[model samples]
Target: MNEYIQRCEALIQELPHDAVRQNEPIYKHTYTQMGGLADLFITPTTYDDTQRVLKFAHRNNIPVTLLGNGSNVIVKDGGIRGITLCLKHLNNIEITDTQVVAQTGATIIGASREALAESLTGLEFACGIPGTVGGAFYMNAGAYGGQIADVLERVLVLTEEGDFLTLGKDEFEFDYRKSVFSKKQYIALEGTMTLEKGDVVQIKQKMDELTIARETKQPLEYPSCGSVFKRPPGMFAGKLIQESGLQGTRIGGAEVSKKHAGFIVNVDGSTASDYMNLVRHVQEKVNETFGVMLETEVITIGEDLKDPVND
Candidate 1:
């Protein structure tokens, strides 16, 4: 057999599942329908498989990238090299009397619905949030005055060295938009959230109010990276952009949403470069007008199409 075939066989032996793909298109997974390809894409079927993949990649000195739900990330057009891990299949949510356990791949919105079904009260704020539980935990994602850190009790993670451990809320050091996961680059496996029993009617009412508020205030009709900028201290990012006359501005196919200045939406086919350019333009204009430089909440990854090495 040729060297390429032999190498493929060896890696497959280590991966031990059919959930692996070569040259996988990443745009299909993202909310904005952007991105190019991933050289090697893996959706592990179990926690054991995830550990195996991480350990194997580490042993072989292969670079590994993590993608969850793809709600707030922009992958450049040149695509990602090495192994890209997307744990979309290891999603399982279990609800108990006083808590809920969600595997990292499950959507936070789905988890909130499960909690509401059990008459739980703590997750009402997350009912309209996009992204997975892993993403939520990674960035301490929140909305409508509630954040994941408040309801989260602990988490299971695989360290960079391929060791598994559980960390409590305090260990996470949850801040405004970050956790230990963001600081230490830990791959979250699952999470446990402590909750309280509430009246189902009341829980649904709260969720409905938040959903309507989100749908009304945000541009949910288009594909976009939900919120592009962090809230400046004592100020709102959207309000600043709107006041600066940046709303409806377009860079290529990416446009600052006229409906909500906080969002950059893909009205047509948009590249990551286009999105980033628009982000920069909005920042420059807002800063020039009000001296408040907006900071990006969205994560950007992958390589540019113009990179010579990629050619």
Candidate 2:
């Protein structure tokens, strides 16, 4: 084995029942169907294992990136440097009286479904969110007028100091598509959500209705991130882009969805560059016409292929 791979393998041995991959294709892990290779990817099976990996990375000064369901990120084609930590193996959901405890890798949709089965309410808004608990908490992801901050009681995170701490809702500092946890770059391990007992039939009904609404409006059939841009203040992002006459606009193989202007879909075999360029094009044109800056909700990583504005 090479030096870096040997180092990662040694680190892996310190953990229990964890898997590691060298040069894993990141595109397969993301919703956008675009990304370069990951130098190293590891999924730990237990909290202790997760902590051990982090401690090792911290001590060695190896750069680490935490990944969830890969639903809202755009990785550049040049690939990622250092270790990419995936929590997919940490998925677990347990119920206790009024609260539900879940690992970071557990899907929000799965959590919402469990809520319905347990006759739990207040999590119906997350039935359609395509992400993990950690990702949801990091972004304060919400829909249908409900957000993570509304239901989250506390979160277990691994601090940079190699200590585990429980942060309450206030500590998270939830906002529109942002959180203090995100800013602090803390690694989330588990979440404890407080929900209410309600009628299972009613909860299921609400989830069904929301799912139908999403299906009718959003392009779920195509491989794309859920939303491309955050809603600018005082204006709906999709409406503004649509009104700016950018629907069906194309940058290489990427195109703003004709059905929903807020979406930048890979209509063909779009490279990461294509999608990013399309995003900037829409942003610039909308800003020029409406005098409103459209900020991206999509998180971008790695080096740019070219300056987007010039394309």
Candidate 3:
């Protein structure tokens, strides 16, 4: 084996019990059902293990990337360059009084359910958000007219130097699908949320209503990355795409979802390139029709889409 591969294997062998993976398929890991292979995917069982991995990577100048549930990102066909640290093993949820403390890898839906079980409100809006706690906090994820900024108290993040720090809500600088962590290079470790005591029945009712609304409106049956674009202020991204008559637009395997204009789904034999082509086409058409540029919410990373090979 080459020196680099040998080093990675050594590290993997010594990795925490929670952090074990080799040649793992990245496609199965994402919501989009795309991507290639990860050289080494590590899921640290504890914060110390996570820190140790990061420290080692930093010391060795090894590249590292943070990945959550793969709800909002697209992995390159070439895969990641170095160690892909997955926070999935960090999943943990705790409730004390009106507070909810959870590790970064815990799903937002799970956290909301925990809140409901505890009769704590303020998280009903996130009942259906398909992302991890750390991802949601970093992006200030929102739905149904509420956002993470509304209830976030503080977040625990790891510095690039492997130090942990607690940042308060104000320090987060949350604004419309963005946070301080989003701009800065920091890894979320866990978060503490402040909620309110409310009638569980009412909270559950709201959650159910939103769930139904999402089910009725979104194309959930297909493999997709949720909304492909962010709301463009004063105009919904879906509405704009629908108005531009861009729905059902297809470029190879990927198509602008007929059910929801905001989604780009893998219809059949779709590739990452197909998705990218459709996204570009939608942007072009929307810009042509409305004089407004539609910004993508789905994070894409891959090589240039190769032209289709003829039969």
Name the best candidate (by lDDT): 1
Question: Model 3 misses residue 289 by how many Å?
Answer: 1.1
lDDT scores for all predictions?
A: 0.89, 0.87, 0.86
Better of 1 and 3 by lDDT: 1
* Pairs that collide, model 3: none
Candidate 1 residue pairs that clash: none
Please tell me which model should have the higher lDDT, number 2 or number 3: 2
Per-residue CA lDDT of candidate 2, range 56-154, in tens? 888888778888888988888766777888998888999998799989899999999988889999999999999999899999999998999899999
lDDT of 3: 0.86
Q: For residue 78, what is the lDDT in candidate 3?
A: 57
Q: How does candidate 2 fare on TM-score?
A: 0.94
Q: Which lDDT tens digits does candidate 1 get at residues 20-116? A: 8878899998998899888888889889888887787777777788999899999999788777889888789999897999999999999999999
Clashes of 2: 0
